[model samples]
Target: MYQQNGEEIFVIDGHVHLWDATEENIDHRGGEEFIQCFYDYHTTFTPEDRQWDLDEYRKYGPDRMVDDLFATAAADMAIFQPTYLTDFYTEGFNTTEQNAELAAEYPERFVLNGTFDPRDGDEGLEYLDELHDKYDIPGVKLYTAEWRGDSKGWRLDDEEAFEFLEKCLELGIENIHAHKGPTIRPLNRDAFDVGDIDDAASSFPELNFIVEHVGLPRLDDFCWIGTQESNVYGGLAVAAPFAQNRPGKFSEILSELLWWLGEDRVLFGSDYAIWNPDWLVEEVLEAELTQEHRAEYGVEWDVETKKKVMGENIADLYDIDIEAKRETFRNDDISQEFGLEDHYASGDPAPADD
Candidate 1:
């Protein structure tokens, strides 16, 4: 939590991963390329002082992740979005099993989200059942462009995909976080297109389709779809960090999102490890639209809007009572151990090294 102008803001990092891309785990050239791609994004947007070396970037481990997000970063709670690239990594890049370990130890600070590939057929459906039985996941992350043997990609509107989505509804999983952003090598660029989301979202009104990266490089299409569909949401993982290097573009994208989807539907995500939440949270709070841009778009980037984007919107989606959660944190042993009590009570920033 962060205190600003005497108001406490609860933050939920809606996208994070506990991934392993060490040289030993690299199964093929694709694995190396994937990590390199992420490194490019990290170096491009991250400040020099906050950047990590290649060794640390490959496998930062759960200890560093926990400290960066919960103890040091301003995130009150985070949701783990698993990405399992079994073809790229020997033991799957980041599986639900791995994230579940961290969530089990610190239940209050994390929400474990699982994943499934429709291409897996019957075996995949059974796996989903087993995963729900073990983790009781509220959501699942789908990477459409993930390579699988001879196949290049699959669409959300496919018959197999619908079957998996129906099973998710039956098992009480409502949120579907789909990666519809930029494309990497070994996958067709069109596979990352956001067009398929329109069909799936319209077909499944009961489920929430949160488009990860908000269909970047195709923002216009996403904004149009978001305007037409009520269940479609925008996840700001890849898009949020642009505020630092490309403020004008970021402002335009944010304004357009608010103009189309309204304030309640936009969710904050640091896409942690690529970029930490501490600075991203601060940047969002401090970011402002120029007078000309505000007049042109007819959008207001105010304090209340900042609060909703930072955490309130996602907290509402997850059925979390913000004040109650804040009270719980106030009395938590971890808070006292980390001196969060003094930091919050005095309205001073959390110590950088603490």
Candidate 2:
């Protein structure tokens, strides 16, 4: 929880990952290119003093991750969204199993989500079942553009993809987080297109389709779809950092989202490893909308809106109780390890007098 103007804002970072892009993990050239691409994004937005060298960026391990997110108490909780690029990495890039190692250690501080590719067929369905049985994942991070065999990508509305969606519903996985944003290395630009989301979101009313990165470069299209599909949501991973170096763009993008999806549907994310929540959270919380943008979009970046976007909305989606979490964090292993028991204690309710 972050104290802004004496108000306790429980921050739940909606997107995060523990990935390995070391040379040894590279099974193909694309693996190398992918990490390089990620590095470029990191350097572009991150503060110079905060940026990590290519070596540390490739793999930071679990201890560093714990300290980065919880040590400073920048984020109260975080959700791990796996990106499995098995073809690129020898052991696969940021698979559910990899993230589970961290989540298992600090279960109260993390929400571990699984992943699936429709191309895997029956084996994929079984794996989904296995993930549910093992971790009871409430969501799945999807890479529609991930290359598999000769096929460049798959569409969410495809028949095979529908089978996976149905299986998700059957297994009680309701949150469908799709990577719909700027093109990344080894990922086809056309594959990240937002058109397919329209049908998928419409067809699956019971499920929540969270379009990560808010379909940047295609924000207008995404906003249009979001307007029509009430179940659709936007995750601000790539866009949130704009508050640091691109304040105007952040204001514009956030205004567009609020105008289209309203405050309740926009979720905050640092896209950790790509960007850390520690500083990024501060930048976002302090950012204000320009007068022109406010007049043009009729949206306010007020405290109430900030509370919802920063954590409350995603908390609602994940069924996390903020007050309850605060109580647990008061003495949890992470708090004791980081000496942050006092931090969580600050959010505790006052005693009732006789």
Per-residue C-alpha lDDT of model 1 across residues 1-354, encoded as one tens digit per residue: 766776667789999988999999998899999999999999999878889988899999988888788775378889999999899999888899989999898887788999989999999999999999999999999999898888888899999999999999999999999988876643335865899899999999999999999998778888899999999999988888878878887888899999999988999998888999868777777677877789998998886777788888778667777666665776565576566765444453322211
User: In candidate 1, how many Å is residue 311 off?
Assistant: 1.0
Pairs in steric clash, model 2: none
The residue-level lDDT of candidate 1 at 139 comes to 93
The TM-score obtained by model 2 is 0.97
The CA lDDT at 91 in model 1 is 89
Per-residue C-alpha lDDT of model 2 across residues 85-197, encoded as one tens digit per residue? 88899999899999999999999999999988999999999999999999999999999888887878888999999999999999899999999986554343486589999
TM-score of each: 0.95, 0.97
Error of 2 at 199 (Å): 0.8
Off by over 4 Å in 1: 186-189, 343-354
TM-score, candidate 1, is 0.95
